[model samples]
Target chain A: MNKRNKLLIRKTLISIVMVLIVIVSLFPIYWMLLTSVQPRHELMNYPPNFYTRHPTLEFWKFTFKESILEFFNSLVIAFFATIAAIICGATSGYAFARYKVGGDTLPFWILSLKFFPPVVAIVPYFLMMRTLRLIDTCTAVIITHMIITVPFAVWMIKGFIQEVPRELEEAAMIDGCSQLNVIRIITLPIIAPGLVVTALFCFIWSWNDFMFALILTRNKAMTIPVAIAGMREAHGLMWGEVSATAALGTIPIIIMAIILQKYLVRGLSLGSIK
Target chain B: MTVKKRALMLVLPTVVVLALIVIFPLVFSLSVSVRAYDIRIPEHPFIGFGNWISLLKNPDFYSAVLVTGTMILAELFFELLLGLCVALLLLQLPRSRKIFQPILLIPMMVMPVVVGYMGRLVFEVRSGPINYFLNMLGLESLCWHASPDLALITILILRIWRWTPFVMAVLLAGLLSLPMEPYQSAQVDGANIWQIFIHITIPMLKPIITLVVIMRSLEILQTFDIMYVLTMGGPGAKTMTLSLYAYITGFRYWDIGQASAAAWLIMIPLSIMVTLFVKMMEKGEKIEQAK
Candidate 1:
């Protein structure tokens, strides 16, 4: 075959492979949507309904009316946690990046906290929260989520901050600016994209985190994941309700991923910088 | 003096919060692991190594260890292979790659608890798609979650699906950063694509791959969300991992001492991995500097 024909064949083959991957990747989610709308009887049919025989919004209505409250709770926790992490991580990242913090070891120490299995802190955290009467509250979840997000934010924002020249901050300092003022005026605008990326990451991670939410919250403060898990009871599986809840829980993150793919990918990869 | 004090003041709040939130809890957990304490039974005395000793003799603990070990290895193996393939394809795609990239990340961004729920739905014995499709294809409908043999494998599939995107994204970044000259030179020397990948790309990508491996392993060892959401370590502790065991012991049994010891056990492997990863990164940096 001619080189051009071979290249065409290769491209066509790759496209076919890509389509197959996309289908396989999306099959479960497609099935999720399909099953969610299918009538309960059809949902449990022996052969299983590939196409919904009688599509209905009954499950969606159930999810929205009852089960989705936990999703809103998750949103609140993730939002507050993201904000707190950004504040903590950004300033600290700036401090490390702009100032020579005596030794390199301190920054490494801060970054290394990210690797500590979140489970390691749960036992005492449970005790500590219990002692403080903070268990089963959004405060406890946010605080625990911060442990995961802050290290990430610090690492990501530090990279962005370091990329901005020291001379800019020096110039701001020469203008009789305080360190805080310099950061606000000279550094913030330059690292705004990075800060946004860091905050979005913190949001996604906090929103997706299950262990902390599952273990920490109860009743009124429960996040969506926990609430979804709670849908299962001793009597029998509530497949329709469970699928609806899971779909509701995942939609927001899926939307965010679609909207900010590049930023999320870059953040996920670069956020781990030593 | 005033400037130095101001800088210290600015840094202090973060330092303090981090210490309270991160440092204090870690130290407290370490202390709790060694003490014979339980919130339910507050009258127990301090007993160092007692919980660890008991855990050492528990067959459930050993099974959890084996299951987690096997699951992590299996998950890591598939994730690395699939992740590398996806990353390679991602690199080769033209401008249209941007369109598919976001959709590919949806799985990774979904909550693990939600992923578990979804996995359960898909793997359901009677109503699940996996079984339905199998029946359609003239095959036996497998009870993926019912048997001890298949329980861990089911969880492993869930883990691989959720995590491979993360691995792919990291490896893609590494691949993008790699110089093109090596491939050109290899091609000039009559090297095939597989040979070039084996001889040149793999060696170049080792540091990032190692980093990815360590991170994924650590997270997998402490996997609780999916296991808890899906099986709750069911089928007679078949899918029980260390974190699940710790959670069950602490929360269900209210045996804080044993739970903390189990958590510490999980941490041992992770700490060693983290140290090695850091050392590897340091060596890579030194090599870069030397170059």
Candidate 2:
């Protein structure tokens, strides 16, 4: 075959595999959305409707009625945690990038802290919360959730901060701007995209947490994930409502993830890719 | 203030917060791990290595280790293999890359707890889509998580489904960022696609391969939500990873001492891997700066 023929074959092969890859990647998420809207009978019906022509909102209604509180709790906690993480992370990131705070090991120490299994911390965290009389409260969960997000935030924001040319900040400093003012005027704007990416990714991560909320909060501050998981109790499984709750917890993140797709690789890799 | 002092001041809040929430809690967890303390029990006493000794003797702890080891290896192998193929495929068509990349990441975005519930529904042997599709292809119904043999396999499938996009994202980024000089040289020298991939791509991508492996392994070692939701560490502890096992021991069984031991056991290997990853990253950065 000619080189042109071979290239054609390879491109066709790539097209075929990509089609399959896209389908497998999308089907489950599509199924979750489908099952959430399907009425009870259609949900359990044999040879399940691949597409629900007569979709019903009953399952979503039940899901909202049961889980609206947990959803809000997750919203409040994840949102606040992101804000806290970004503030601390950006400043710490600035220090690490600019001043090499503490020592050479300080930033790595912070990153390594993130890799420590939450299981290790769970026992003490729960005990600490109990000791401080903060167990089963949003404040308690937010404090711990920060543990998950802060290091990631710092690393990501550090990468973004490092990208800002030092000369710009120095120029600002020479013109009588203080260090804080230099950061506010010069660094923050340049790294604002990174900060947004870090915040969004941090929010999704804190929202997706199950172990922390599962261990720390029982009833009052139960997050959406735990509440969604609770639908699959021992005796019975509420598939429809489970699907609905999963959809509720996932859709917004999926949308934001799509919007931030370009930054996600950087965010997920903790800036190693850049 | 001098810049150094101001910098330290800038770092202070994060350092303090992490100390209180992260570092302090870990130390506190270690101390708790050495004691026979259960919230339910009135008399909590220091049991000095008793929990660790007892945990080492327990068969279930080994099972958790074995299960977690297999999970990390299998997840890494399959996700990397498939992710590489798709990533290479994506690299072929820059025009279509942006359009399809976001679609590919949908699975990665769905919450793990939700994936567990969704997996339970989709893999239901009686009426699930998987078995239904299999039956369409003339295979008999096979129980997934309910079968002791298939439970971990089921979990691995769900994990790969969710995480392959992540692996692909990293590797694809690695692939796209390659210098192109080697590939151009290889093509000019009449190298085939496989030849270039083996001789150039693999060697160039080795660092990233190790990176994704270590990172993903660290994550897989902490497996909990999916197992908790789907099997509850059953059909008979067949699918229990260390994280779930620790959670069960600490929270469910209320054996704080033993649970903390199990948690620490998981942490040792994890800590070693993390240290190695940081060192490699530092070396890579050093080499880049030298260049």
Candidate 3:
């Protein structure tokens, strides 16, 4: 084959593979959505319909009824946790970035907490929450979730702060601006995008958490994941209701994931990529 | 405040909170691991090394270890291999990438619990789409999470699906950031695509590869949400991972001592791994800064 023909063939092949990747990537979610809308009879068919003939909003209504309260609980907990984490993480992250506080050991120590197994902490956290009489409260779940979100926020914010040059702050200081004002007027604006990303991530992590929410909260403080997991009927899973809830839960995250796609690799790798 | 005090003020709240949350738990778990503690029991006595001994002897513990080992190895291998291939493909299609990349990341964005439920629905023996497709391909239906033999594999499939996107995104970013001169030189020297990739791409991408491996392994170690929703580590404990085992022990059985012991067992290696990786990352950063 001529070189042009070969190049054309390779491009076609790449396109085909990309199409397949998109399909495989999306098919499960499509199935979840398909299952959610199909009426009970249609779902029970041996060969499932690729496209639903008669769709129903029954399951969506059921899901909302079952999980709306838990969704509210999740929102409150994740909101507070994200705010707390951003507060604790951004300040400390700035300190680490600018001052090299704790001489690297402290920073590494803090980052290591991100990798600490939630299982290990679950028992102690459960006991502690129980002792504090915070069991079955949003406060309990919020505090335990900080263990995950704070370290993550710290590491991410630290990386972001490092990316913003120290010269700007120094220049501001030389201009006789107070340190706090320098941070307010200079560094904060530069790292505002980074802070937003950090907050979104902390929110998602806290929102999607199941293990902590599962072990920590009883019915009153149950989060969406726990509620979705408990959508089990007598025979088997409440597949329709579960999918409806799962689909709803996932859509917002998908939107956020798309919006944050540029910073995703950096976030996922904990800034190692940058 | 002096500069040092100002820095301390900035750093102190996080440290104190972490100390109470992270450090205190470390010590608390250790003490709990040594004690013969049960949530139901009133008198909890210290039984030095007793829980650890029994945990070491327990068949379930060993089974969980086996499951966890298999998960880490299988998930990492498949995810890395598939992720690399997808990333390379995406890299080849720069124009299409902008449109396709966000679509590709949808899987990773799905919650783990939801992923588990999806696995159940998609892998359902009686009416699952997978079985229907298998039958269309002239094959018999296979029991996925329902059968003990296939439970771990089912979980692995779901996990790989969720995580391969993350690995791909990271590796793709690494690929995009790579200096182009080396590849141009290799091409000019008559090196083929395979040679250029094997020699040039792999070496440059080593740090990112390490980053994904460590990150994925740490996550796989704590594989609970999916398992809890999918198999509950069942079909006779076939899918019982260490985290699930620890959770079951602590919550379901209320054997806090044994659970704490299991937690420590998991944490020790985790801490060591994190320390090594952080040091390596720091070294890499230093080298980069110097350059």
Candidate 4:
């Protein structure tokens, strides 16, 4: 074969591999959507219906109508937790970056806390929450979520803050601007994109969290994942209801990803690569 | 004194919060591991390694360790290999690089619990698409998650699916950031792609690769959401990872002592990995300075 033909062959092979990767990556989610609409009787059909033969909205309606309240509860908890985490993380991150109040070891120590497995302190957290009369409340869930989100925010924002040249803040200080005013007028505006990314990450993480919500919250503060897990009954797995719940849980995140694809992608890559 | 006192006041609130949320809980977990304090029991006694001793002897605990070990090794192996392959592929593409770059991160953004549920549905015995596709290809249907022997393999597959994008993203960044002089020189010397990779690319990428491996391994060791959502350590503990086992003992059984002991045991491996990572990073810094 000629050189051009060889290149063509290679391109074709690579395109095929890429297609396969996309299909493999996307098929499970596709199956989840397909199965959610599948009728109960047709769910277990052998040679499983690749496409829904008798598609219905019964499962979707059941999930929303029956468990809508729980879904709202999850949304409320995640929303508050994300806001609180962003506040704590951004302020502390700014403080660390600007003020040399503590040793460098302090920031590393804070970040290292992120590596502590939630399971390690989960039992104690549960007990502590109970003692504080915070069990089954949104406050409890939000506070527990801070353990994960604050570290993530601090780490990511610290990187962003360090990248912001120190001269701008120093110049503002020389102008006799208060620390709070410098943050509001100068620092926050400069790091706005970073803050947006950090907030979205915190939101997604809090929404995705399952273990803490499962252990700490019962009915009042249960998140989406816990609600989905509870969808299973003693009889058997309600395939349609479970699938519908999963789909509902996933749509918001998928939409957020598509909308803010740039920042979300950049943030994920930064956290992974750096 | 006043200035120092003001600085201390500013830092104190954050320190107290961290202590309450992080340090205090860690110490409490350690104490709980050595004490007999079941939530059901009001009065407790200090057991002093009784939980640790019991866990060491338990066959299920051993199984969990084995499964966790296998999962981490298998997932890391595939993630590194495929991640490198994809990174190389991305590097070769000149025009579509920007478009394809962001698309690669979709998997990492999908929630782990959602990934698990998606896998669970796809790997279902009768209705799952995997079995359906296999049957269409003139192969017998395989029990993906139902079979005890294949349980860990299923979890490993899910893990690789969810995390390979993470490895790809990091390696891609490293590959793109690298200077082209060495590779060009290797090409001028008539080195083949394979030779260039082994001699030039791998060495240059070692520090980043090491970082990815250690970070990914630490995260994988503590993985819970996917395992819990998919199999719940199912088919007779075949997929019982250390994190999941700890969750069961602490939360399900309410065996606080045993759970805390298991948690500390899990941390030992993680701490060792972390120390090694820090050392490797320091060595890499020194090498870079020397060069």
Candidate 5:
């Protein structure tokens, strides 16, 4: 074969493999969506339908009936938690980026806190929340979820802020703008996109949390993942309801994931990428 | 205010928040570990490592450690391999990276709880797609999460599926940002593709590979939601990771003292390792930047 043909064949093979990876990666989620709408009997058939022949709104209703509250709970909690995380994370990120807060050591120590396992702190957290009569409340869930997202937000925003050179802020400062005003007028606008990405990530982390919501909330403020756990109790595992709830829980993040694709490398690596 | 005070004002909220939520919990949980503090028990007394002693003797704890160890190792191996392959492939086809990158990230975005339940639904022995596809291919069906032998594998498969894209993303970023002079120089030296990849690509990607490995392993060590929803670390404790074991003990069994002990058991070593590892990462990044 000619050299050009060899390259063509190689390209085709790579495309084929890429197609396979895409399918494998995305099929489970598609399967989950399909299972959510599959008729009850259809779900348990000898082989579950690859495509639902007779899709139903039954499982959606059954799952969403109880899940709607939890869904909203998840949304509200994640929103508030992201706000808390951003407010704290952005300021600290700015401080670290601009002021070199505590020199390099302090920020790494704080960043290391991100790696601390949930298992270690959760038992005490549960007790603390209980003592404050905060169990099963949105406040408790939001606070606990904030623990996970804040480090992420700080690290992410720090990178974004660092990318905005000190010259811009210095120009403002030289114009007699106070440090605070320099931040408000120049830094905030510059890092706003980064903040949005960081906040979206915080929102997803809060929304996707099962461990915190499971331990922190009971009925009053049960989040969507907790609602899935609740399904496990009613029936052995309502595959349909579980699928429906899982699909519902992931829809927001899936949308956000697409939007944040460009930023995800930076976000997921906690700004290590940049 | 002086610049220092202004900086403090910017950073104080974060420090206070971390103190309350992060550091306080560390000290508090460690304290709980030393005491006989089960919610089931009426009296709370400082036993001074009695809980730790009992947990050391607990067979369930050992089993959990074994399962978690196996799972983490397996996931680290598979995700790195698969993620590296996909990353290399995407790098080869730069034009298609845009089309494929977002789709590949869908699994990473899917909720872990959703991953757990979705694992159950998609891998169910009798009616799951795996078995169905297997039977269609004229192969005998194998029980996935239901079988003890396969439970960890099922979890690993799902874990890798969720995270390989993460590995791929980070690696892709690393690949994309790789300094070009080395490759061009290597080419001028008449290095073959294999030789160039071995010397130049691998060396340049080392920091990212290390980061992905350490980060993913730490996560797999704490793998809980999947085992919880999919198997409850069950089929005779075949899949009980340390986190799940601690969770079950602390929450379900209400054995707070032992749970606290187990949590510390995971945490203490983990803290040392992670701190050191993160420091290495910082050092590595500095070296990379300097180069």
Candidate 6:
């Protein structure tokens, strides 16, 4: 066979494989969306309707009516958690990057916390929150979620801060700029993109959190995932309502994933690879 | 302030937060692990290593360990293999990757809890599209999560579907960042694609492969959200993972002391693994800097 033809054949095979990968990756999400809008009766079909003829907004309305408060609760918790993580984490990140604060072991000590299993911590946090009278409150969940987000913010933002040249910060210092002002003026602008990425990731983690939210909050501050889990009734899962909630919950996350795609490797890998 | 003092001030909040959130819970959990501390029970009696001994003896704990181990092995194997394949394919088609990569990542972005529910809907024995597709292909529909034999496999399928993209993205980034000098030299030596891949590519990608392993193993260890939403370690504990088992023991049964012991059992190896991986990661970074 000619080289050109061989190359063409190879490209064709690759394209076919890529197509299959994309389809498998996307089909579940498409199914979730399709299921969300389908009429209840239509979903029970033996050959399951791949395309819904009669789309309904009833589940969407029901999700909003039942879980809107929980959704708001999630927003509040994730927001405060993200903000707190960034404020605390950015300072430590800058210190670690610029000054090598805590030396080698201390930084890894912090990084290890990122990987600590949430299940282990949940038991104690539950007991602690109970004693503090913070159970079932957003405060408890927010504090609990800090376990995940703070370590993440520290490492991710530290990596970003490390990328900014020391000369720049040094130059600002020579100009008699105070350390705090130097950070606010010099480091912050340079690492602004990194800070945003770190904040977004922290937010997404808190937003998508289930186990902590599930364990910590009962009802008053139940996040969206907890609310979705509670959608079940005596007659098996209310699949449509569940799907509706899942679909809505996923949209913002999907958008964030796309937006963060550039920094995904660094963020998701906890800055290990980058 | 002196430079040292300023540095200390900067890191204080983080230290305080982590100390409160991470360290305190950990120490509290350790104390709880030693006691007969049930939330339902008022008087908590200290039972040194009692909970630990019983947990060690429990057949169910062994089963959870087995399930968690099998899952980590299976998911890591499949995800790494499939992820490498997809990354190589995307590398070949950089143009198409722009459009398809984000589309591919949609699964990873789907909340794990939702992924669990999606698993239920998609793997529904009779009405799930998977069965319908099977029927179309002239195969009998099989019960997925509902069947004990297939329950873990069902969860594996969903998790692999969600996480393979992350693995692929990381590997793809690694592949893109690879220096062209080696590939060019390999080409001059008349190495075949497979030879170049096996010898040149795999060795160069070792650090990245290690990174994926570390991250994915940690995640698979904590595989509770989906298991909770989908199986709840059910169909007779066929799919019980470590995290799920701990959750059930702690929350549902409210055997706080035993659960704390179980959590510590999981953490011992986990913390060891983390410490070791962090050391390896730093070593890898030093090598990169030297290069």
Q: In angstroms, how far off is A93's CA in candidate 2?
A: 1.4
Could you tell me the lDDT of residue B159 within candidate 1? 81
What would the TM-score be for candidate 1 when compared with the true structure?
0.94
Residues B1-291 of candidate 6 have per-residue lDDT tens digits of 598788999899789878988888889999999999867777899989999999999999999999999999999999999999999998988777888787887788888989998899899898999999999999999999989899999999999999999999999989998999999999999999999999999999998898789778888888888888888898999999888888899888989999989998889778777977898867865775587
Residue A22 deviation, candidate 5, in Å? 1.0
Tell me candidate 4's fraction of native contacts, as a decimal between 0 and 1: 0.46
What C-alpha lDDT, on a 0 to 100 scale, does residue B247 get in candidate 2?
94
Q: Model 3, A101-194: lDDT tens per residue?
A: 9987888778778887889889888888888888899998998889989998998998888888788788889999998899899989999999
> Candidate 3: where is the Cα deviation over 4 Å?
A233-236
- Best by the lDDT measure: 3
lDDT string for model 2 (B6-125, tens) is 889889989898888877877888888888897867677988999999999999999989988899889999999999988988998888788888889889998999898888878988
Q: Which residue window of length 10 is worst by lDDT in model 5 chain A?
A: A44-53
lDDT of 2 by residue, A172-198 (tens): 889999977887878888888888999
Could you give candidate 5's per-residue lDDT for residues A1-274 as a string of tens digits?
6998998898889999999888988898888889889888888788667897788988889867868899889889999999998888888998898888888787787778777788887898899998899998999888877777887788778778878988988898899999778888998998898899989889888888888889988898999988886788777778888888878888989999999988888888877776
lDDT (Cα, tens digit) per residue for candidate 5, span B1-291 = 597898988898898888788888888888888987867566789999898998999898899999888987888888888888898999888787899989998899888888888887778788888899999999999989989899888888888889989998899899999989999999999999999999999998997888887788788778899888888888999999999999999988888988988988888668766876778757855775487
DockQ of each: 0.63, 0.81, 0.82, 0.49, 0.77, 0.80
Better of 1 and 2 by lDDT: 2
Off by over 4 Å in 6: A175-178, A233-235, B287-291
lDDT of the structure predicted as candidate 4: 0.79
Instruction: Indicate the docking level reached by candidate 1.
Output: medium
> Which pairs of residues have clashing backbones in candidate 4?
none
All models: lDDT? 0.81, 0.88, 0.89, 0.79, 0.85, 0.88
TM-score of every candidate relative to the true structure: 0.94, 0.97, 0.97, 0.92, 0.96, 0.97
Error of 3 at B226 (Å): 1.3
Distance (Å) between predicted and true CA of B227, model 6?
A: 1.1
